[model samples]
Target chain A: MNINHVDLAGYLTKSLDADEHRQAEEHLATCAECRAEAESLQEWTMALEAVPEAMLLDGPPDDADLLLQRTLRQIRQESSGANRRRSTLVGIAAAVVVAAAVAGGAAVGRFTSPSDAPPVAQPPTAAVSSGPTAAPGTRTATAVDATTGARITVALTPAPGWIRVKAAVAGIPQGERCLLQVVDKSGKVTLAGSWLVSEAGADDGTTLDGSALVPLDQVGSVRVVTEGGKQYTSVSL
Target chain B: MPGFRLQRRREVADEALVRSLFAEHGRAMLAYATQLTRDRAAAEDVVQEALVRAWRHPESLVNGKGSVRGWLLTVIRNIVTDQIRARNARAPEVRESPVDVPSDEDHAEQVVNAMVVVDALSQLSTEHREVLEQLYLQGCTVTEAAKALGIPPGTVKSRSFYALRALREIKSLSPAGTERSAS
Candidate 1:
């Protein structure tokens, strides 16, 4: 007996009941045509499964982090403002701009200063003297944008409900409004703070301070993104 | 003040749930979306939308019997499908060529299966994952994988067989075809 598309779908999805599933399996073992079709489906399934790991190996574009952050923020807004349905629609409009930033592949190079031709080697330091109690050890990570050569160094000091983030960033486009965001282990992101890049500071690099509403341990990474939601640089912490 | 405290507690709980969901499955979901859309930006958009949808219907995610990763991937699939349909509608000229062999439904189903398989892969043991990763992901022969993983050739073959079997046994392998059907 020939297996139809519906049966193939059922078999592939495991929607078939036990008896039918067993029969389909038995039939597939013998029928050449059905076996070929099943093999094709299985091959596609394997290809699909391999894609994610492959992409990870390939290194996802920088803006990918920014996109996720903006999306989470939008979702939070929608959930909290359930009554303001119209505003949610407006948020969708704004998401398009964010999407465009990612698609355009904005360059995030390090600003070259007359004093320093090579990449700066300063370790990120946390200004925790005045903040709430700090965690025992400071954690830091730095990432450079391959395209723009922009660099961002994130220094995280653990706190109870919030972690103080001190970032030193260079190579951001002068005068672009940018935000510092912290993504927790669960992929939850909080706005650390926002700042405008100064023309002189862009060349010399600038330091910004902010705090995320998550403890130090919960923090996964820190990212610098343009006001339009294009990620300049990110470093896993 | 007590009422405010209760609301804050609920908010914290919800936030925690969201964070946990992302931590466990965010990478897989992003990869699945990236595959479907072929553009990191568009993929991010799909993931973002699906996540927002998840937030709106947190109960489906937190309480539903299906795997959260599977559910999230399914949502991403549907969103991609909608975007494709919208694009085709807006520019019928592009669809006139019919460059792709698989119909939208077939592609969508394949995507669902792919996500399920990826999620299953994540559940495998480190050894199982390593064997499969070397063989399938890195295109290594059994001997090559064994060499790379510091295992014997025979063990590599055996591990590969069992890993495949384990992948086949993942119970929630069905594609969540639609939003209504997924829940």
Candidate 2:
């Protein structure tokens, strides 16, 4: 039998039957299109084998056996559930069961999160703000210290187990000493701390002065009060 | 045979089957799992999970026809994907601080491996690596790879063919390739 184009394609990929495969090979010997298809498949498979296995994982995890056991148990549980639910419609139910099995495997793959996401911009004021902490996902907040005529801009982020705070000054001295405090929304100071003047002013640029992951049970918002009492900044946690 | 003896025989058979699989492709499966997950720990997990998955879904192996290695890789990829999704969902947002650049000594081997593989794979198009990953490393059949990627199986096969050729050419260009090519 002559090989149809689809047959040639399928056969070339080992997705077709015996007669079709023979027809495809026979045609491929003469036909440029089919020949090219066969050649490409060979090359692709070779390149794939060339890929080093090391790129796949950072290091061997200790939890492999545990996860596998858990997954298998979960799979068995679901299989038993399905079997119990539809002991009557055996044929149709088999198809559903197979579909579910495939889906479960696929579900396991959706695990890799893209490692890179857009970086959140830190407002200069976040480093200097004297206001209560903003909500979770707030990017920037402004706080004005009327006493010192210093506008403290602050930014806060919920890092793992710690709230990160940054502040910038508008009119305050660049090297002024300050106390950074995390307080509840009710203005009750909880964790009070100090940071030396590593940076201030737009020209001074952003600096990694210091940060601590506060206990989760600590205050909700962060407030910065300059030792000189010249400027202050605060942001909600 | 007594009923209890018959049950014991079945258990022995199952154990033998598992052992045979471990002997046949354990290291290869481990390597493939490592590649897919990019974590040694996760790789081990993938291997274990794949084996468990294979045991649970023996029908997926298509009797004795399909490659056991390929089937295992598919299981590994699936498990890795699920883990990645869960990690992403629970990942906490944090300030953008520069990632601590590892000391050159820390990732030297990794860097070398990455460079070699990337150099070889980069010769092929994204489509080529992707198809190869799905078919070989990820352990999908041509049909399955095509279906997952929304391409024709023919395309997948063709892509695979060219990708391998390009890789061989690249390998030949490298010192390692020179040795293999001379063979």
Best by TM-score: 1
lDDT digits (tens) for residues B47-97 of candidate 1? 778877765664454244344455676788878877766665655665555
Over 4 Å off, model 2? A1-12, A26-55, A62-237, B1-119, B122-124, B152-155, B158-176, B179-183
**Alpha-carbon interface RMSD for all candidates, in angstroms:** 15.8, 24.1
What TM-score does the first chain of candidate 1 have?
A: 0.43
- The alpha-carbon deviation from the true structure for residue B152 of candidate 2, after best TM-score superposition, in angstroms, is 4.2
B135: Cα error in model 2, Å:
1.4
Tell me how candidate 1 scores on lDDT.
0.54
What TM-score, over all chains together, does every model reach?
Answer: 0.45, 0.29
Tens digits of per-residue lDDT, candidate 2, A65-105, equal 45444544554454445543422211100000000001222
**Candidate 1 CAPRI category:** incorrect
How do the residues B1-183 of candidate 2 rate in per-residue lDDT, one tens digit apiece?
343332332222223233334433454456655655556776666666676555444444433322334445445555655665454444445432223222221232222233244335534455665665666655678878888767887788767656665665655433443211111
Give lDDT per model, in order.
0.54, 0.43
DockQ for each model: 0.10, 0.06
